[model samples]
Target: MSATPAGSAGAGDGVYRTGYFETRLAADPNRAVVWRHICDYLRRWIPADSDVLELGAGWCDFANAVAARSVTAMDLDATVLKAAHAGVTAIVGDCTDLSRFGDGSFDCVLASNLLEHLERADAERLLHEARRVLRPGGRLLLIQPNFRLNPKEYFDDYTHVAIYTDRSLTDLLTSLGWHVEHTFARFLPLTMKSRGSRLSFLVPWYLRSPIKPLAGQMLVVASNPAR
Candidate 1:
């Protein structure tokens, strides 16, 4: 990712700077390959005809790929609001404060590589907002970097604030009254398009195989508290 400018918008506001996604992925070609399979894998777990909302959706990669009846890509950067993928509606909003959306309005909410960007309080607020926007039994799918797996380099991103692991993430959601539906302690390799050239070919196999040793990230799927 490119360096954030000194006076750039959102520098201290805690939102990711505009053009961050493009700059980060420009150097990697395999990210495109990996995301194709990753999207497919994630889509299998998402029910068809469901309305989906993606929090902190950068460039709408997964949002554009998921097989939902409707897709809304919410990001802190307004840059996404104009040029989103076809069929995906883009909006500028903070994940921690989604009062603009009514309660029980969506069937699924997605966040990838997002939780670590917020402070503890903000992350908790985001969790609550996600739950509130979801219908009863609706799902929340998260893919976040695991501090346990990438402790040495987790801080490489200057914007990251909250670190998490499988256990901590599961506990956080459960404590907030959500049901932990599924947990993959090691799901994907760190960095969308870096560290390995074989990743493009290996991702599909890894998702199918039981072992994922190089995975620097984890997947957590949860459901709203059943009334």
Candidate 2:
């Protein structure tokens, strides 16, 4: 991926530095372990040899753990540079504008707990760009808070400017010409800050279980159709 100019005016760097991760996302070690398990489960859609790009890659948990041929982590915050692992490339820029990457540059694009941070319009642009950067038949994976399941806590994060349920997110992706592949309404817990998230060992079991106990997040997988 090539480099692009920063400053998109979405969520600035201050929000990340101001105790957001320090307090709310304090479970760094646990998050890493949990992400590894999550990555293992996600391997069904993401092939090991595929190049992957992770948007809003806070702390680069997914980018670092995913088994991919090449990994690039993008975030508005510069802290991502330090969080990225040896093989991962960290870029500080706006997620909505992926101009730095050429068309069909990656086989997979991931946006976890990211869309909600943008306004609806920006979210659309982000998804559009995500698709534009993916090769034909490439997949776009999203793990987002399901507003329908956790209405009360959906807005707990001050940066959350938009809300989406499985249905709405599916609609949005379809409108952008992505072919919806899978939708898991109840995938993971709402916040990793919770005690339930600390139980990383249970993640594999939870992912396979028919009934998820406290799942408030949804996982949506879409593919870029051949033109």
Relative to the true structure, how large is the alpha-carbon lDDT of every model?
Answer: 0.78, 0.85
lDDT of 2 at 209: 98
**lDDT (10s digit) by residue, model 1, range 27-133:** 34465567678878987667888999988776666776788899998877665565468899998766677899999999999999888877777788889988999
What is the per-residue lDDT of model 2 for residues 87-133, given as tens digits with 9 covering 90 to 100?
99999888888999999999999989888877777788888899899
Q: In lDDT terms, how accurate is model 1?
A: 0.78
Those runs of model 2 whose alpha carbons end farther than 4 Å from true positions after fitting are 1-13
**lDDT score, candidate 1, position 227:** 74
| lDDT for predicted candidate 2 compared with the true structure | 0.85
Residue 43 in model 1: lDDT: 78
